[model samples]
Target: MVQIPQEILDQAKELRAQLHAAPELSGQERETEGLLKDFLKKRTTLELVEEDGWFYGVHREGDQLPNVALRADMDAISGENGPYHGCGHDGHSAILAGAALACEGKTLGKNLFFLFQPAEETGKGAMQCREMLKKEKIQAIYGLHNLPGFPLGTVMIRAGTFACASVGITLLFQGAQSHAAYPENGRNPAFAICRLVGELSSILSPENYQGLVLATVVHLLVGEKAFGVSAGEGELSLTLRAHRSEDLALLKEKICQQAEALAQADGLTLTISYQDEFPDTTNPPQLCQRFEAALKKSGIPVSQLQEPMRWSEDFGWYLKETEGLFFGLGAGEDCPGLHTPEYEFRDELLAKGIQSLLTAVFL
Candidate 1:
């Protein structure tokens, strides 16, 4: 195992604390980016490249080695009071930075690139950084997330889909309003929206698809709070998720078709839109094998998962452009789950996270 020096570990801990103390929201991580960039400059000799909203570090070995990239999300989630690091992105960014420190004097054969991405919570970060893969000619990439409810230091890997594909869907209905006494005179969408909600279960029945498919009704609305005015508008919001991209696409089509039919039946104008889209984070077999071998060589405890995670990861965007492996670093069974107010990143995982990255590139 590659041992990280005590002083470098100390620095990493300090960096993680700094990041955790002052978190920024996605797409507005100016200060977060500044902190990470400054940390890299002070610790590593890797050439830094700055982009519009994100940045990366390049370590060239002068050998004709294949370019490999390692990525970490840097943006925090928006909490009730303010932005906070409930998602542990602070730990992730520090891990990549710590790895950069460990890689400074090493003579590795691979050209290593470290990506610090922003806006991951909304599924926009990887899309912003996808162009970097093509520009750097990166042959392969690797990334990891800390998984609670698992034994600490255990590495988790999956064969095909590591994370599911998901998208936020919204259906807006518009109709003519009339007096409360003359309800039939107005094209109120209450009946149509209620009917759609009632049919959700049947539409998303487990028997309808081969893999895991889910459609959740996150929100529903029918007109205003005022009882005197007949309701003529409504909105339905849903979150669609599936283990396969094709299944996700088909699920979306089915829901939209159903909504259109309901709107047509009521003579209401319907508009459908989507946001926070993510593809499935599928791992190529060869790359998965390579990562597993690297972890084993370092004697890291590794486990294979039978099913893909239901939560969406923007890292899927990177896999669309190149072969990559996205795995999980366990945060202990007793740890608080991600995005919880009680949750904070486990600083003890810093050295191990760095070691895994170093092994993937240098082992």
Candidate 2:
């Protein structure tokens, strides 16, 4: 194990706590960038640049032709009304910062890049940064997420399709209003909404490829406030996630087509909006071998995950640019699942994550 400095750990913990107190959602990671910017600005001799709040700091260690990058996400998941740091992203960011601080004047075999990516939760920012980083001669890039299901200090590393593809769905239902008593006076969208919900719930195949389609009316709006009048207009926001991108595409098409058909039959108009798409994340084989070698050399408990999770990350885009492998680090036994209100990151894993990154860079 490398002998990391106490000040480095202390500074990392402080940065983690500061970031934890005010977690920002995807694409709105200003506080994250600010924290990392301030923490890394005066600590080392790396070159830094910010692209749409995404921070990339290049450490010029040697004249190696191919560069190695160690990356950590800097954005939080959606549904953060106030600042819930449950995902341990703070620990990831702090570990990246600690790695940067530790490698201040160390001898890395190649030019090292520390990528502080934004919007990993939503799956857009990684592709955006990937386009920019594609111009550079990067031989390998590495990334990690905090794992709660696994044991602490146990690295969950795998090659090929570790996560599934997902899509975000939003729908709107619009119709004419009428008096509550006069049944035929106007078209009530409530009936249409109810029918759509019912249809969406029961959409499944009789054979294999078994999956569920959930149509939750997250936001509902009615024109009239009084009970005497029926609702004329209604809106819905739904999220569609599946194991296969083809499944996602087919389901989305079917959802819109079914909803449209239902609305047309009910004398109503429907609208759909889906954006910020992300595909399945597949880790390269050679890169995964490199990670396994590094982790083995570092003497860490490592495991190849059994199943590919439904969760998606934007680093899928990074794989398109250069050879990269994204892995997971365990926080603790009882850490909360991500995006929960009571989710708080464990701070003690900072040094361990940093050490892992250090081993990667030195390789």
Candidate 3:
């Protein structure tokens, strides 16, 4: 295992902590991208190809052969409910930047393409940038995420399905207005929304929805925020996550059925839309084997996960388009679960993650 210089590690940790304090939600990673662009400037020669919050850098040594792509997402989540790096994304970005710094003048007979993507939180960035990569003619890809249950310096690798599919769903209900005194005059959408919720909840079983069919009413509003007036319009929003495509489609069908039934019964207008759909991630065995070998060479013990994660990732889309491997950088037994308010990314993993990526890049 190559030891990462202390001076470099300290600088990476400082950058991670600074990013953790102020994270921008999806599409809004202007400042974060700016910070990364500036950081890369001090490291290598990066030519901006596609504008609009996305960047690519090349580490060239008089030739470009065996071109490979390394990606790190730059967007933060909403329930990040405010800026605190519970997901260790800050750590991911830092490691990517650190790997670039470490690669200065280092040649593996392969060219490096560093992609700092935006809006992974919204599940749209990968597909948007897909067209540009075709011109680069990249042959290999490797990405990483921090795992909470494993020890620092530990890496997790598996052949297939590292993370499940995730879709963010939003539904709205509208009904005719009526007087509170005359109950029969108009339909009450509040009651219809309640009924739809109940029916949807009952069908979300472990067998029916696959991995996790969670439906949360993120927004439920009726009337003009006044109890005295009868509501003419009502809105309800939810997020749905599924392990299988069948389950995702089934859940969507059930939601539409329940909405239609509720609309007919209550004489309300129901509008449902699916947003922020992130497909399930499947790791290529061939590519993952390379990483697994690298970890073993580094003397890092790895625990293979028994199952794919229920949490969704936009990285899955890339796996769909090309052969790739996404692994977990273990954060230790005491690390907090991702997206928690109190959870903070482990600092020790910074060195391990950077080393792991560097090992893969050169191998």
Candidate 4:
């Protein structure tokens, strides 16, 4: 295991606490960005590059090019009180910083890029950083997320499909409204809405496809709240998820087709739009083996996941461009789940996460 200085660990803990106290939401991460930039400038001897609310630190020697990249997400989730680091991103950022600081004067054969990304919770950060990555020529990238309900400091990973694909779809139904007493005079979409909700069940059942496919109704709006008017316009929102991108596409197509047919029968126009799309994160077998070997060599406890996580991660976008592994560092066996108001990052995992990431990069 790489030994990180006690001073470095202390600084990381302080930074994580500061970040946790003042969290920023998705695209609005200006304060977080500024803090990170200043920290990198003051602590590391790396060249800083910034673009579109995301930044990277590059350490180069002679003509050697950067082949491996370590990514850490920087944005937090909106909590009941306000924005907070309920997803452990604050710790992730601190780990990346600690790793970069430790590598300041180290010698290595390949160049290193420490990427700090924003808006990971909403699934837009990775897509925005896609163009920036194109200029780096990175061959393999690695990222880690803190996982609750697992032994602390344990590394959890799988070979393929580390995270599932997901997308949010909004269905808009338009029809003519009429007085509640004279509903027959105008087109009311209540029937279509009811039929669509019933048919949504058809999209479920993983057996329909070779892998897991699920469509969940997140929100539904049926016309105005006023009781005097018959419901004319209604909206339905569903989040689609699958183990593979192809399965998600198939599920989306089937849902849209069913919605259209129902709308046509009820004399309503249906329009479909999507948001918060996240691609499935797949880890190449070779890359997974390499990462696992590094963790074992460092004497870190490792766990092999029996199945891929059902949650979606934006890091899946990065894997599309290069071979990479996204693993999980256990936060604690009894820690609160991520994205909850009670959730807070475990400070002790900062050093372990940094060491794990550094080990993977060097391997």
- TM-score of each predicted structure versus truth: 0.98, 0.87, 0.88, 0.97
Report the C-alpha lDDT of model 3 over 179-296, residue by residue, as the tens digit: 7777578777889888878886686877765566666677777778665567788877777767665677888788878888888887888888888898878887777777777778
Query: Which candidate, 2 or 4, has the higher TM-score?
Result: 4
Residue 269 lDDT, candidate 4, scale 0-100: 93
**Clashing residue pairs, candidate 1?**
none
How good is model 2 by TM-score?
0.87
- Ranked by lDDT from best down, the candidates are 1, 4, 3, 2
Off by over 4 Å in 2: 1-7, 61-64, 76-81, 206-225, 360-363
RMSD of 4: 1.2
TM-score between model 4 and native: 0.97
Q: Per-residue alpha-carbon lDDT of model 2 for 1-363, expressed as tens digits?
A: 676799999999999989887688877889889889888997888899777778788878566556888888877655647545656777888999899999888766678888888777777778777755656577878778888767887788777777767777777778888888985888777777677777775553423244433334455565658888877887766677665566767777877888898889989888888866777677877777777887787786678887766677777677766777778777667877767776677776777788777766654
Q: Score each candidate by Cα lDDT.
A: 0.90, 0.75, 0.76, 0.88
Worst 10 residues of 1 by lDDT: 354-363
lDDT of 3: 0.76
Across 221-310, the per-residue lDDT of candidate 1 in tens digits comes to 988988888999999999999999998988898888898999999999999989999999998877778778888888888889778989
